[model samples]
Target chain A: MSGKSLDNRRVQKFHWMSRFLSGWAIFRQSFLGKIGLTLLALFALMALCSFIPPLVDPMYQPMAGVDPEISTVTGPSTRHWLGTDFMGRDLLSQLLAGARVAFMVGVSAAFMSVFLGTAIGMIAGYMGKFADTLLMRLADIIMVMPALVVLLMLAALFGQLSIWFIVFFIALFRWPGVSRVIRAQTLSLKHRPFIEAARVAGASHLRIIFRHITPNVLPLSFLYMTFQVTSAIIIEAALAFLGFGDPRTISWGMMLQWVWKTGHMFNAPYWLLPPGICISLITLSFYMLGRAMDEVLDPRLRKEGQTD
Target chain B: MGNGKQTILELDRIVKRYRTKGFFFGAHGQDVIALNEVFIKILRGEIFGLVGESGSGKTTAGRLIVRLEQPDQGKIYLDGRDITGLKGKASKDYSRRVQMIFQDPYQSLNPLLSVFDTISEPLIIHKIGNAEAREDSVWQAMKSVGLSPPHDFAHRYPHQLSGGQRQRVAIAHAMVLKPEFVVADEPTSMLDASMSAQIFNILLEMRRRLKVTFLFITHSLAAARYLCDRIAVMYKGNLMEIGPAEEVLRNPKHPYTQALMDALPKFVHSGGVKRYETLLQAEREVSGYVGCPFFVRCKVARAPKCSREKPPLKKLDDSHSVACFYAEPGIKTRSGGKA
Candidate 1:
């Protein structure tokens, strides 16, 4: 009996492994997926390396530490790999720290929104009639307001915004889009026979929503999360570049703000271009990742003969 | 076997209608009657078959019994208790005694859940036992459904199993709770001949072992003849005939029931087969809900009589009744039809 049970466990593990491997195989076939994965890996390495520079020399810190010798913006040299900023902060260390911030802001904001959106969408869909109309109308109202513009208004009202507050605001504004997608998925899923079977088996409304509907809608929610991450990163970058960012953090947008404020936008390409390029590249990689995942989740997008 | 027996479930004048969602304004779509004043009484420990064509409301009757949908009018009684408007805990308690096996095995089982999880769900919901006891119950249920060596099939998902295997798993799910009444809605409609026979045997075994009453809804008269103790023929949301399976097949009274028997496939080489010749080749055009539901295609239907007023079910003999104005009971013994 124990041997048979062990075999059952092995079969389950094998099935999961094979499913993951097949998904990976499909993910590898897309050029965008390959490029995005590589670029994201490079940024992850940069985020990891951000801690190394400050440890090597205190002056190499992206924020408070400043070079004693170099007081003004300068071109790249043997000493300063990417030169110094107007405040004499190391641009290389700042760009690396910017990668860390971009990942932090993007993933966390996306995760929070996706979680909130999935829960709300399932509730609205499964409990139709009044709750459906009210929640969906609320989503419609939130979806129409421009996230960046609203965040700007709030930033202006508050004077200065914290990093966590920015992430939270981004999550709040972005959830409507995810909620709409998740709600549509949930609507279709709630009518399936399996859901009716659960109801007939004496499962409560709460049990049906959490135990049955949640697992089915979770894949779609995950696919939407990747897309949400791209928007979150872009929104955060736009806010930071507009000078509404937190004062303490050394993000890519904050780096670009410093370069533009110090009148070094045209002269110092080394100081200005790194943060601008980093912001664009990170967002592009995340967008590519989302597109690739969309193909994985929706089998209709896959080629005919490629099915396992 | 059902003579003078206890009544387990009953449907009294159940009416269900559905309306399509109209435009945002005040426009309303016409109501489609799914079940029209349908009445049925099921005997305890008997497999009562409800046979009909598509859109004939046979499935609706089964769904009503399981409380998946409430009747628009009238009431449903389970064991002499009116259970039409049960709510919350009452509804849950009702579900403990009544369960359902849905049509389409592929669509019935949740793909995310394993066979063990699916079968044990009711046990967990009813708080039947501890983890070990639930496991034991699931094993017993699976074994009764012919899924032997329980651990081998327990962890498998619906996608991994064949249609027959999936349906057996579905049966295990319904039987694990040991419900007294089960509504099996076209359980074998999606399977092949051999697989369907296997499912039929499993259902019979369940009834014999557990003494569970069943409402077996199907479109196949042949299958009903093979499995049901009593059968009811429905047409366009109306019950046409109700009788013992052998008596109905051997001596059909209603023209619609005769038409259903005539439509069954027979061997070309068979000699001297009696034909009912009761069905009109093309359907007669009729407007509105009036008269007999089968009047449109019934060849025996008389103008101004069958087209003007509906015929209520009249008792023919002991435990046999049919709904027809001109039905001749025990006169036409159907020849060359095998049970």
Candidate 2:
């Protein structure tokens, strides 16, 4: 806190920061939010440490690094920590690298989908009548198709999908659900007096949609992004387990696939449980994050007697 | 035209109708006539009062003048230039000189916007000035609206302010551009008595300092009497009476106006608050009728004449007009002013 008065820009920034801090205060009280944040932090740390093992020892690399001494799957020991897989690759390093992939696939895909959905929804809602009907019907058409099945068909048609392509398709398939929620939010906001005030203030339609409507709907969009992250990660994991995932990437689903394919599904408990547990926990954490955010974004969801 | 003053805004036979959605597809429900051939002329620098009950189309009329909605069958002239169908640059230009202050202070200001952003919005939209100059304009507007020590309130959001403070911010938002005409639609309806008085005083100050013409739309007769130079009473999309505020409040001519005056609760000690008792206890069914809108509820209405025809505005004096079959030079009541 400076003694001198803050300038206009600083004041504007401070306003948003204060809003966020207050929201954080409310968010911190939710049990789900605390657990979700701690789990996410752990996964983030694991993702960050994924590069360290490969740097210290080449054999600890998740892919293309074989332990010269181990020829078959082994139980946990000082040598490999979690254990060595049938391919002589370290399961712990593979699990850490999988965390990195999960974060990448989840966040990038969720961000892209949310950005697309919010834009389309705001336009469809603000520019009602023809544009609204057309866009909503299109959203309906895309939403009904199962995303995973479509991705499998695409993978079959164009062999060996890249990791980035999977993220892109996940985004493409995932936007309609977000668009529906955002569109509904935008519809409720369209007739609010504030929007009318903006129009009466001589704002162009573009200005009203972007400047006025965007900020109002953005919190909802970001809340949906957390839920979208959960779905994107699950979809990617499913694709990798089904062997449609990018072959070059080391993901938890790919590790599960290796364990199942090598007939170690019953014998290798160490390799099997870690990747499966990691996948489920990461998705659960994101879902919990979304739930807490939903409570934060909508005040009506807060418990009775609570006051801002 | 009544006192040789310039008419800043005129609504010539404005009619606005909204069609309600029917139960089934392709079925059209009744047209809700929000405004029906309503005519008004607001003079430059005068506070014109538009008084009506709820659903009387007063707010709709305000929305029309501000171009929030277009009149179905009329021309709105700003300084004699027809602005009913203004589009593109012309419409944007029209908005620069015309503004509105909405009724609900809590709903009118965007919750996400801070005080500075809300007030400075008009300047930004119109591209009026650079950042520093815009800040100066916002500060000046805030000061004029009594949001002093600009730094203290500039960063505060709408939720942090009380009802009156929010209304002041709303007024500042409307006044920032120094618009020539403003339509304040029941701006103090949601505030407490003292806050309403504060808002009224701010409006008076704005008119005094800026010389901005106002069409003050409200349902409160006392508020209209306090702030308006001229007052027009509306009922069911029809204007019942239009006159100088004092003359109209003191000696109301129309039966509906008399009923409205009769409905005001009088103090026991107040001397001789006359009641005309012009309202019928049982409302007459008026489906598909073309008579005066108030004919169904008027106690003094006559059958075969008042029920058969729609009355046009008839002049009783230089500045007073009423739409009634049997309007007379109203009996003078001892004016015990302000309760």
Residue A132's C-alpha lDDT in candidate 2? Answer: 92
Candidate DockQ values, in order, are: 0.63, 0.56
Which 10 consecutive positions of candidate 2 chain A have the poorest summed lDDT? A1-10
- Superposed on the true chain A, the predicted chain A of model 1 yields a TM-score of 0.96
Those runs of model 1 whose alpha carbons end farther than 4 Å from true positions after fitting are A1-15, B268-270, B333-339
lDDT of 1 at A165: 99
Q: What TM-score does the first chain of candidate 2 have?
A: 0.97
User: Could you give candidate 2's per-residue lDDT for residues B167-254 as a string of tens digits?
Assistant: 9999999999999999999999999999999899999999999999999999999999999999999998888899999999998988
- Model 1, span A51-145: residue lDDT tens: 99999999998998899998988778877899998878788999999999999999999999999899889878888899989998998899999
lDDT of 1 by residue, B1-339 (tens): 646898889899989998877878869778888898888899999999999899999988888888888889989999999999999999999999999999999998988788988898999998998777888899999999999988778988898899999999999999999999999999999999999999999999999999999999999988999999999999888999999998888788988888887888899844666678788878888787489988888888877888899999988887899999887666763322221
Candidate lDDT values, in order: 0.88, 0.90
DockQ versus reference, model 1: 0.63
